[model samples]
Target: MKQDGDAAVNVPPCFISNHEGFRGSIKNLIRDFVVTEIDVGGRRVTAASANHTSPCASSDANSQSSAQFKQESDASTDCDVDATPPSFDLSVILGQSVSEELEQFVLTLKDETTAKQELSLGCFPDKHHRANVHRVVRHRFPFLMTITIQPEIRVREDPDYRELSQLVTEDEAEDFFRFIDAKVRGSSYTFGPDDSKEHRTAVHHFMSRRFGKLVETKSFSDQGTTAITVRLREQGRPKKRSGEERKEEEVYTGFTLRKENLETLEAISYMAAALGVLPSDFTYAGIKDKRAVTYQSMVVKKVSAQRLEEKAAEFQKRGMHLSQIRSVGEPLRLGRLQGNHFDIVVRDLRRHGTSDTHFSAANAHTCLEELVKEAVENVEARGFVNYYGPQRFGSSQSVQSDHVGLALLKEDMVGAVRLFFTPEEGDDPHSHAKRHFLQTDNAKESLAMMPLSKAKERLMLRALNRYGTGPDGCAQAWLSLPHSMRVFYPHAYCSRVWNEAAAHRLTTLGHRARRGDLVWRQEGQNKLEDAGETSLPQIHVVTEEEEQQGAYKLGQVLLPMPGNTVKYPENSMGTWFQERLARDGLDKCRFRVSSLKLNLPGCYRPLLACPCNFRYRLQAAEDGRGEVMGGSSRSDRQLNGQTGEGKQGSLVLVLNFDLDSSCYATICLREIMKCDL
Candidate 1:
């Protein structure tokens, strides 16, 4: 019914169906082919069918394509699944070295000269590029290359003084004190149970074990407490006591201060107070030199004498003891004694080939002199004030985990209430474990929801690269450097990531560590409601020159108050910390980087594993001219029969600063001094 010229037979413009039958029309729609009739030279008519691929197809064919698409998608998903594992465990503690890396990273920003800098792949300042280069070195040659950094140090005080003091232990308590009777002049003394055989044996044991060669008694008595009489001699002869003015107080009764000097005695008294013991119980007769070993007597109160003796027994284990006790009714007084004795031991020393071991001792003596002078100056400058140091509550015993715990207490809940009643090792290791577990689970979920957080940060950096102008991408630029400077800024990014992750884990998993109780609004009144109790307020710490000076002035004005109450809250520490940061001009200041100095003393020859280069020597010349190794061994000697340069031992010198309480001085010193290699 339709002719080839008919416009009603609408088809694709690329093809014209010349099907003369109904079957041909159906076939043209089913198959992707075109039917056309062409005339050559306007003489003959020809029929042709052209086959091609069709974009449009049946539902079954589309379903097959979708299935193939899903297979490829699954393969890609599996590959990505292996990239981010569930967990990681690194044994190393990323500390000071990491901080230096971060410092270098910041310094390398190219647009740092400008107000703002853009972060990108390649464009970075020298310092930043060096940082990245160091990171690469660390990744590639962890063993061959080492990185060292300075640490951010902060000091803190303990808040459990009252609770720790009041919680007494039986082992540290006293027993009954026995009074020795001397008024009745007895011919012989016997000690033990009232039985004759037991009394003789007890008397012999007491004379042998208790008195030793220090004291000799003629006789002893045993009732509830034993009594011993001293056989006194006068002018190389035994003397008889006159029966006049027989004082009962002359018999042994209680303990008293053995110190002779007033100032040291007062210092010890104050120290005892900090230790939660009475001045009477902290008796030492003569003031021992601070630089030497000294022995003195400490008295105990009659009521608490037994417990004080027990505690003294504990001190005895640590080279301190109650050598003797005397009855001083009005409590122990200072300034009535002789000098102290000292025995010193020094070991494991390093000696120079030129200097004897005695020289090292002399150096130590000089060091000690300087140390004592500094201590005296510091005390004098501070006006000899008395304040509790870190050791008052054994804070020095805590390690890095304590710091982590402190941060958690400020930001996590579980850590806030995790009670460690005693200062023992690994106390409550799992206290924060469960909390961290929960937080990690939550973080996993929440961070996923915020995946765009990282993506956006990266995108922002990239956009800055294109539109903004500033510093080079110090983050990545270091990768383009040669081998030497590659380890300059090692672990910069990784440390930051690790710290952030750790903080996040602690805050999320640990207890909610709020600074203080929540603020409450008054109900039906203008007055505020009660808030919950919290730990002691934290002190504001400032290290900048101006701010620190200001703080020092403030400290001078603020006198010590009783108990732990203070003018500021713990939350103020961070705010003041920010002020110090601004004062230091750290946000804008530039740093001059240096390389690490390594010493290799006691060396036979330089090894390949060593990072240091050795001095080389030249052999004799073949020509008439003579060649000297190290400028001729003969010329090596200079005036006074000494070489121009003396042989020096290899030693690694690392300069750093540590902000810690006086009590934790040993902790810092040990960490620095304990490095053998």
Candidate 2:
């Protein structure tokens, strides 16, 4: 027999045929009871239906809800359990129930008195403890229907690491994947995914966007390379060295350059050689392209500023020029580039021949339009997914995002259950029950906090710390779960091997980019600390020089009264600025200014108008994944009247770029512009 509300119990080999006589003594075990007699070899076996009862109390609201749902839905939730009843007849073996004659003989050999005593001992164990034996059997057999469920982990698409250099040809791209697959040995690499769904979503986001700017980019026939110079972010002041430390080491001035997707490195190397120093003596942050313009910082110790200047002159003789040289403060590392800025000049005048002047300006106009549109769209769409980028994991490894996701879901499910448990009574009953039975808060506190917002943040931090590797691996877990959970309590089980696995894979193989690729942003003026201690660099907008030149003319139109007659509208920063300019008589003025600045996050900087024009600064900020924060500001809002907006009336070119401490923004920008550099 089975316990109440549980499944049927299995029959032990020692059951007696006459045990049914005592069935009346068992409470709740008599409902629709059925028994079957079977003959095994020469012995008799009985199969009896285990007793079951409806749940006595629905303390768990979720469980109650499930029950109610089934009651109303007319579904077959119980079909699997009730399909087979325990009442079939199986006493006969091939139509032969232990021969009557044999049965009689066996009965005679074993006296009824002795047989009854043995049967009683086998069924009841100790005569005085029949209830205990029954309870033991019920607990051990657990007459419930057995269920087998195999969980499946989700699969995520690998992150795309394709760069200008990586896209040599279709075949080369295939080969690169193959190389990566081989390196991973089919170990299943994930792109720092917290869950499969999130990973897939991120992949789709990347698929929808373009990599770099459009106007200045060019195509390559073969697997081409570009040189990019990654200047180490300058340290405002040098670290003080102790006398003992200073004397312990030789002050080596320069380092060597290695090959990669850069042209600038080659030029720099050539220049170094001409200056009577071996290429090995010139240490660079990273190698740049030979065909494209790449800029970086180089260090030379023991050389005076005059000698450095002389070397610069010698480099110019060999088609290379060193613009400026500061103290070689630190050793340059690889894969560092501030964001890249491009000024491409495309010729061949597809529309008009070299001699014809009036053939057409159509092609130039079309090209310009296409270039601007592509740049805006690509940047807006594929800006950032915020997960650990490919660089965090090596080019060869992929992460299993599903594991991270499941851990997150498990957390969520527990939280949901807890929410349902919250009753107006302050849950004193549930608390007592929980303490007495479960003695864990996993299904309560830990899981209760798994909403998308909270969970996503935790997942992101987990990914960042794991793959980004600013701090130690174990320490990253604290960023996710509550600190109290770390004590000898419920949180102990939260940090399972699986959870740690997701984090483990994150830190070691974080670098996802192959080679010569980057994420670009503008360099802003102020230090990041000024932007409310923001995590990302600050990117403030600056007026292009071209615009600044026309400021005096523009000011003349807007400031007719000059004496602050009308203050700019409090809510109409953009409109007031525009109306002020319109009042000036320079309506037909045509000038374009191209401005460049570091696109950091959380910082706002104003753009200066020409000598007299009003200044408007850009406010661009990005999150952990190089994603721009804040929406389109007034400056970014293109003017769209009957004619159009952002139609440049002035033109000026500025050359500059900014990179993070560990990234090469120039390479990233080059890939976007499709330029040689």
Candidate 3:
């Protein structure tokens, strides 16, 4: 008997519990699913838990000692007091008399009214002359900044270089140069992709010499030609500070982030934008579900508590709240948390294969409570199959993330790109752009049509336009995505295989410590804390004696996701892994993609997940009166409005449980409900 939803990802159909399941819908409203993070120190972070103290709070003597050490370190690097500043003449090197312009620009810097000023030294077409000008500005005038301006090239039509070579004439050549001059006022030159590396290097050198060493040159391919843009680097000089002040400055601000109906990245992006910092500057233990009210710990580098507090109102308007703003010695890293505590309300409950008529108004509450109690008790005793939840596959019904991963593993770059850009059904915001690209094969035009919120799509489109859709181009396109997003595709594929393998193991051999099964040694479990989320855990195969003695429980048994480094079970399950990979057009060796640096040395996951501190209650959900524990009345109003209509007197199973990091609460609910989620 296969599970109702097993066909989508080939999950195991068996259930650990033998009790009758209750019928209900989860996530009927956002507040119905509440998640709170548990920190490594076993502290559950809630919206109201505010810690004003800093993580680095220490004795005054220690602080003074650190400050003194910093002062000495700075003193050691100080230049000699008698050293003389270098001087040079810019007029001779620039081949012009620009002393007046330089003097005027310097004068503006002293005025409080003038915010910024730039002095453009005339362009030098000669490489040697440009080099001398750059050298003079750096050593002689250390305070002044310089930049090289490159001409922007817009290709009117795709040019055939072979045909152009045959039709070129002296007048046409002069006309082309004249057009360039008209476009950019004779500031720079353009080169084709076919240009030799040495030629491109010479061009770069000429630009650097003509401008200054501070100027940066970047190359991009457009329509079979490489366009190099030279511009001033935007980095500013660091503010001078005393060594003691530097040591006293807090490096990070730790806070508890409470958000509703928002993804973790989305919330972080909003905060980063408001704080005038990149999203990469913020770090967190794990990603939370988007359709739930979640509370998690987050830390941002160099951001102050006051700054974060000022944005509290704005965040609240967007369904997010920040609290516990305090100074910390270090940023929060992924997997630093112990786990998450969930408060889930499964509503409109009924017995499986029974209708609402089965529960008359007289005994509705009593019947539902008995059913829920039995199911919860079974889960508490036996636990549930630790299958990767449906969300892991993806929200899309048309295309799954694992599909893209398989394409990448098979070295089908073009296929992978297409799969990533494939739009979902019914009014997808990115559908217009994706369809445009699929139909016209014009990445540039499609990019213009794409929304800024579709960052991954836009990133791929930009790379496709600049790099083309060949193997190397596609690989580069994937590489251009953020590391977190890039790893998701391959990781999704690993999850799919792991789910199937785990299901097979339970179905074939039962959830028990088999002789060939692998389990984490005691020390290996200890290393899990220090290894972080990305690192693999150590494991060893169980011996016959250990299996007979029942040294390892089902929860200790491990299953490997397909990877080059992972060890499969030493039984028929191991052969099943090889067969599954063969069907997917892959072998163990293919898991390592050196070009992309995507070496999926997959890790082990337990076969069973038992929820801690588990408890449940069957509540009478009346019309316009449904309430969620730990949720605001306003949120309860929203939930009641959405799910309470015509659901009066219906029973709701409110379950409270704590799960270890990476375990899915949905799987636990699935075993109790025993129906498609």
lDDT of each: 0.24, 0.25, 0.64
Highest lDDT model number: 3
Where in model 3 is the C-alpha error above 4 Å?
Answer: 1-10, 49-251, 273-276, 302-306, 355-361, 522-538, 588-590, 624-648
Best by TM-score: 3
Who is ahead in lDDT, 1 or 3? 3
lDDT per residue (tens digit) for residues 1-677 in model 2: 21112211111111101111100001111211111111111011111121212211113334323321121111111211111212212112101242232233335432645332111112111111222222222222222111101000111112243331222343433443433322321232222212244534444343234321111112122334321111111221222346243321223343222212224434544554455553334454433333333334455444444666667555555444454444433444332222112222112111111233311223323443344344434432332111111222111112222223222223333332222223233344433433322234333242333332233223323443354422332234323332211111111111121122222222322223111111111222222221111122222222344234432121111111111122221222324334533444212212110111111111111110111001111112122222112232232223112211133211111112212222223222222333211
User: Clashing pairs in model 3?
Assistant: 130-209, 130-210, 131-209
419-497 per-residue lDDT for model 1 (tens digits) = 2111234424332332332345232332233323222222222333343322223222222222122221121211222
lDDT order of candidates, top first: 3, 2, 1
Q: How many steric clashes between backbone atoms does each model show?
A: 47, 78, 3
Q: Which scores better on TM-score, 2 or 3? A: 3
Which portions of model 1 miss their true places by more than 4 Å? 1-297, 303-320, 330-346, 351-418, 421-677
Q: Model 2: which ten-residue window has the lowest total lDDT?
A: 16-25
- Residue 440 lDDT in model 3? 84
Regarding TM-score, does 1 or 2 come out ahead? 2
